[model samples]
Target: MILKCVAIDDEPLALELLSKFISQTAFLKLEGRFSNAIEALSFLNQNEVQLIFMDIQMPDLSGMELARILDGKKNNDKTRIIFCTAYNQFAIEGYKVEALDYLLKPYSYEDFLAAATKAYQYFDRIHNTPVAKSAEPTATQEFIFLKVEYQLVKVMLKDITHVEAYKDYVKVHLKSKANPLLSLTSMKNMEELLPSEKFMRVHRSFIVALDHIDSVAKNVIQIGDHQIAVGENYKEQFLEFLSKWMS
Candidate 1:
């Protein structure tokens, strides 16, 4: 599948490099290039692209800010983001916006190709033909794939105990693993993808599996050893959920 893509970066060299990479990739078609997020936003308003390769730091509007805006839009799901930055600290923040992948600056062609391949696979899976789509999981889909360290890993929904948002990534707490599976994705993305009947976002940074919640006290949810506090914004809904089973 040929993915229509755009590039946004404040640095002229970065934009040039990204453009070169897109040109070399057979499956990617460069639709636009912007030196600022403001212009990029204007372009996005009028056009639709499957993927975006954007730099994090920019004048007036940063990539992170732009990502949040895009994520909140009506057609937000139509576009996927791949963040390119020089700073490693923003990795966790990138996932918060549900970025498809993170590309550190001075990356090689191979690195760019790997990320593009992921975008292609993602678009193909979601926009498959009728027969193919029919064969895929329905609303009761039991699992999802997450990009971890540049590779996609299949995670069983039932195995997840909770998901905690880190700085730029999310830690998928699982019952079977001693340590959480760290993936480059946002909690919002996880929340939307998960079955609402089974998962609930108790905090801005936390999503807990309903079945895995052992107890709730003082507006805090206990799952295994984790004590997750329900955010003020989410407390009302969570209490309503609890009322259904309370004596």
Candidate 2:
């Protein structure tokens, strides 16, 4: 069945781009396009939109703000989201909002297809489950808040690439930011705190953001310019992950 989809962004060109993409894919049916989040919200209340392609920046209401407004409701509508943004700074928060994936501005048709594929799989997974969602544990998995503890730290939840283990300490690689921050903690503990579906512990020293992965070489996984090794034990699971996108 074709999935009902909608696009929301203030830029006319951006909406045009999404429209073109929807036309290319037979399974995606464009239901509506909104220039702002408020209009999109009102339309959602009355329409059956199964997927949303949203922009992070808009007049009055931003996409991040819009995600907050949609959270924790029993829509049971199985609507998936794919955020379209220009800035890499929003990548982390994009995950926080549990976006299926994001399309960076200037992205190619292949890129949009990739993110859409992920979104489709996500919606399918949730629909087949007919399951209940357990509440998240509080006081667990707190983020590395930025700029509060003096100048010594400033990496927010939305700026991290991965956390590497160094004995009892773990090193966090910041997104598009110079230098990684060192934290005294076990990688195992961190894996528990982070949403397992989003962050994968492919190595004792590496817990990477699945969406940030650029390429996976024989022994290394590339997140932009950084090259991370694939531990022997975790190699199978990593390969299995790549299999999902093989098509």
Best by TM-score: 1
Off by over 4 Å in 1: 129-247
Off by over 4 Å in 2: 130-247
Candidate 1 global Cα RMSD: 9.6
Writing each residue's lDDT as its tens digit, candidate 2 over 1-247 gives 5689999989999989987886666567899888999999899888877789989999899998888777655673477678998888999988887777788898766566556645554555455553454564322222332211222243444567888887756778878768777655557655754556667888867999887888887868899788899889998888888798575
Worst 10 residues of 2 by lDDT: 142-151
Cα displacement (angstroms), candidate 2, residue 29, comes to 0.5
Cα lDDT, model 2, residue 105: 96
Prediction 2 global C-alpha lDDT: 0.73
Q: Candidate 2: deviation at residue 157, Å?
A: 35
TM-score, model 1 to reference: 0.54
